[model samples]
Target: MADGVRPMLMRLRRNGVHVGVFLLGAWAWAGGLLPGLLEQWDDIAFLGWQHVELVALSGGAAILVGVPLGILFTRPRFRRAGDIALQVLNVGATIPTLAVLALSMGLLGIGNGSAIFALFVASLLPIVANTMAGLRAVPPPLLEAARGMGLSTRHTLFQVELPNSLFVIYTGIRTALAINVGTVPLAFLIGGGGLGELIFTGIALNELGIMLAGAIPTALLAVLVDFIMAQLQFWTIPRGVNPLR
Candidate 1:
């Protein structure tokens, strides 16, 4: 009990620190530390909207592609193919995001479309790999029991395998989300609007406050999304399976 409690306490402390830092930064920014940045709040709001839209578009694509591919690969007929597929995905993941973005921009001619495509590719590996791992981890006896009970393959998959694997699957998704949020800023490089617009603009103008104005919001958005996902994970996971809960 003490061991578990210690980690929980530590996590709380870390969260407190994050909140403190965010508040401090907001105070500085609002108090005229950056003479003209406050005036750009409208631009910040618009860019933030773009940032979220890009993440949503790319993340949705990753999930749509990754989950089905993961399921298909796990089938008995495709086990070998699954192995090969995972390796290919691993290679895709290993490629630098900027390189992918650059290549995508060349092919798609820049803008949000290219950015979304690049981010989708970057986010796919984790979802696929995690889904595969989660499904594979299902106990053989549990599957046999389901079969003995005369459950249809489809029913068994949806009711038993998917439920059992959801925790790990969500972990992968959460990871992908984090990656997507962090990567979205790079969209500005390709004329795909995001907080990166402010950041890069700040760099060009040598204004630290302008950069912070962008950076703080981006960081906050990531944290907020991560927290929401964590809650979803907690609620979706079976109580029996969730040791922490």
Candidate 2:
């Protein structure tokens, strides 16, 4: 019991920085720094809730599209089609979020749907690329074993191949998520709205409480999202895959 308690205490100390930061922020807020932040409570609310919805929809879309596409890479024809996917994902990853917003503004004219479109485009390549890599990484012998067992191609994939590749797919999704979190800042720019608005407004005003209030929550939200993704990886990937490795 003492040994376990010692390690747990050490971990608490390591992560205690968050508590200190939050306390400092609470102090500023109580002291009446950046009082104007209280005025925009509605904006913060809209930004937080809508951004959550936006990320959920966009991230789900990425997963559905990426997983199946990864499975498809097992086909002999994948090589032939790889170039098209590469080009599409290259465009997705390379385009700036602002440029995506501009294109959407020209076409969709700015709304949650427009925001989703931009995020979807931003999210695809990592999923597709990682899926392909994971499928390719399956040891050739394991595939042969599946074949020798007389499994159909589809069976081999759904059962043997996909499981082994799950870790890779999880990694891809997590990376895309981190990218999306960064993109949340742009949502404020486009009127997709989120905590980013609060942070940006606070920064513009140079109000310590407002800045801390807005910035702290955004940072915490990113951490929260990252934590959820970590949970997902643990649940979906087999233990042998070595998440860290």
Candidate 3:
């Protein structure tokens, strides 16, 4: 317990420093941060909420679909197909995020639908990949032991395989969410409506304050999301499998 606490404490201290530096930098660059933030407070709040919604919708869908698909891929019946699918997903992941958004916009005809679909595609590969990897990484000895105890396939999967692999699976989720937060800004292009409105608008008008309005919040949001996910990871992952423990 002390061991885990120490690491968490150290991490918090580091995060504190990062927050401080970020604020100091913002203050220096923008000068009188309050006026700028307050100037567009209404837009910032509204757009920020939109940004969160985009991430939640896309990231949630990825987890729901990716986890099951990954589990299916690992099964003997679907292993070959899974391998091919994973290869395809890997190829898909390599395509630029903007291109994915453009493709979705082309198909979905713009709006939140296109943005969500694009973000979902970008977020899926890691979850599926990690789920498969984690399941396969279960030690052979454990399988033999479970079999010796006459555990059924379903029992082995739920009681044994998933528990062991949960840590890796969580890591994948964290990665996917981070990607979602970062990529969400692009959704504005497809009329998805997010913080990107301020950012791009600021750019167009050459207003540092406006750009920082969006950029700063987005950066803070990314950090906050990652932090929340980290806490979830610590609490939910089984202690035996949890590296932090």
Using lDDT as the measure, which candidate wins? Answer: 3
Local distance difference test, per candidate? 0.90, 0.77, 0.93
What's the lDDT for candidate 3?
0.93
lDDT order of candidates, best first? 3, 1, 2
Superior by TM-score: candidate 1 or candidate 2: 1
Q: Which residue pairs collide, candidate 1?
A: none
Q: Who is ahead in lDDT, 1 or 2?
A: 1
lDDT for 133 in candidate 1 is 93
Local accuracy of candidate 3 as per-residue lDDT tens digits, 98-171: 99999999999989999999999999989999999999999999999999999999999998999999989999
**Residue lDDT tens for model 2, 69-93:** 7667557877768756767777677
How good is model 1 by TM-score? 0.87
TM-score of each: 0.87, 0.81, 0.89
Residues 1-245, model 1: lDDT tens digits:
99999999999999999999999878876877655556778888999999999989999899999998898999899999999998988888889999989999999987888999999988898999999999999999999999999999899999789888989888899999999999999989997899999988889999887887788789999999889989999987888776548
- Cα deviation of 227 in candidate 2 (Å)? 0.7
Q: Which stretches in model 2 have alpha-carbon errors above 4 Å?
A: 1-43, 203-208, 242-245
Ranking of all candidate structures by their TM-score, best first: 3, 1, 2
Backbone clash count, each prediction separately: 0, 1, 0
lDDT of 3 at 224: 98
The reply for model 1, stretches above 4 Å from the true place, is: 1-31, 34-37
